[model samples]
Target: MEGDLERNNHILGDRWESMMSGHMTRIANEKGLDAQNFRCADCTSPIGIFYGAPRLCWYTGEYYCQNCHLMEENMIPARIIHNWDFRKHKVSKRTMVYLTQQWRDPCIQMDEVNPSGYRYIDELKKLLPLRLQLATLEPYLQTCRMLTPELLSTRLKGLHHMLGNPHIYSPHDLCLVRDGLLYNAINKLVQFGTKHVRQCALCTAKGFVCEICGKDEIIFAFDDMTSQCQQCKGVFHKRCFADRCPRCERRHNRNTPL
Candidate 1:
């Protein structure tokens, strides 16, 4: 997980630099290009005074010939990252193909890419809590040997990643979020997982009893009313375990040399 995060951070850095360069190119081109030797950005085909000016690709802010830029339209990652814009713009065929292939890759980290953008996207805000709950339930669900992939296939459908990891999101996922479909899908997944853990005998055994309250009810670490000890990892009712964990102290006394 640490390695994955480090790789993602590196990718984000590269993407940020590319987006900034593209933005600057667009700004510079706003006033029109000066008379010079023109060529396609991809194929390097001459599109000069004799062959007319090259077509502009809205994605990379570069010029390309008709063969290279077939007027294909696609969502720009730069626009999505910087402004959360989903509108498609005219792009080169190569750019379109690349974007399409990368659409389903879980690379985008919205918090790092655009922190303030979350405030503008209400659906994303709603999805955040559901993802957090799902993240918490992942370990319990995975421990249930009886729980098969076939059982979850219908509920998860296209979003198997929700069960595995919650932080990373694909561009396709964001599109679904924008359409107000992903939230419902994830909400149902959380409900399904919660139900499974509560009912399954294998999952139920994993639940922690509130040591402080000495209650018969089995509670999970994910429960809002439960608190976990940082040292001993003992779970207890929030009200019962006010600040400190007694179990940690007891364990410490036992381990200490007399």
Candidate 2:
């Protein structure tokens, strides 16, 4: 249905033609919506809002393809409740978000939405407001595509850690982050035709570094990079690091086995 401005034009009688002209122009140029996009979930084409028998409800602000909120009124199922959660699903006892309520239509279930991680979550990705998903994912995926294994050890690993820093808006938006790091770190050498990208940061080990210290001391290279030492300032691999510092519980004045 058209808004007050458009409806008022139909009533004004005097300026109706000009008002109609402006309205048509505005409709033709709507931002992310054209007659061809996102489709009406039922008719497989686009038209705005419901004119059918109690069609889908566009709650929560965005036009959802799954919700089918813009179809004709007759096409809309009367009630939709989420069976998984009682709060979202009390529409009826059958309690399934089916495409229609007459018990004949196929249910639009979430299992069909793909249970894999975000990397494979295209249905969820598709549900993202169409205007922004490509714009957002494109640059991000491009950066992901350009990653050489060598740069991944530091760049990709840190990116994963930073996403979980508890400062971002939605930390869950990136549950795939740690996994992404591992994926990139593993496929990195293959993608760029290299050996190891990042080195173990703890005691100079062969794998990635420890989360404790930002050092590459997989073998216990002391200093500030490795874990704090009980020995002098000298850091060593966790196993090799001997407690010889002044605070050492095992330090003997004589030359001890340390």
Candidate 3:
């Protein structure tokens, strides 16, 4: 079974490479430049480093931001890419950083279901990273106004409608909404934001499972400080597994989420 899973992963990795190569070629052709000189598919900026490496697309093999990459993977609502033209809503540098921290980055790797019963996922606490949540309420908050809980819920429901009512929308419809949203959101942020940093792709916890406890849920996702073993690429809840890898029996330093 483990072998099969590894085989599948290998196959997926190869397919991703092929598709990405094709994507880059297409972009290069569109822009009349070699893929090597091309910038991020969304931002068109030179790649920068974070966590000590140039931020390259896992699929596209191009420099890209974590937020845009997550949007590409549907980790966040693709619609947010288009929900508002952030370029038009520009603020000063100080305010921009504050807003990015408070309103923007939070939405990156957000869970599908939010605390206020405004959920994109049917199950509670089942995460859909990069999907927006109460952070969607940020624009309203910045206006120095408050949305009653009921109003917030109503607005969420309405946004869900604009995204084709994911609750009742067919799987195909959901894909369409996500694709559209991603394009719009990525285009705007790459153009407007003052700072761009590479975020680790694994931070999303998309396929992570705990080796020590054998439960996936409640394991850490972005910046939650979960412990990881470098050699085995295995993750564990810090409290459950400490100092040694249960699978490899290797004793080494554990890394915390960034």
Candidate 3 lDDT at 185 equals 41
**Residue 87's lDDT in candidate 1:** 88
Question: What does each candidate score in C-alpha RMSD?
Answer: 7.6, 17.7, 21.9
State the lDDT of candidate 1 residue by residue for 58-164, as single tens digits. 76667778899888897766576656688888888877777777778776776766666668768777778788789878887666788876776776687877666
Over 4 Å off, model 1: 1-37, 48-50, 228-234, 241-258
TM-score of 1: 0.76
- TM-score for each of the candidates: 0.76, 0.20, 0.19
Flag the better candidate by lDDT, 1 or 2.
Answer: 1
Candidate 3 ranges with C-alpha deviation above 4 Å = 1-206, 216-225, 250-258
Error of 2 at 208 (Å): 18
* Rank ordering of all candidates by lDDT, starting from the highest: 1, 3, 2
Per-residue C-alpha lDDT of model 2 across residues 94-167, encoded as one tens digit per residue:
11233233234222232322233223544233432321222222223234434554665554444343221121
Residue 46 in model 1: lDDT? 80
> Cα lDDT of all candidates, in order?
0.74, 0.31, 0.37
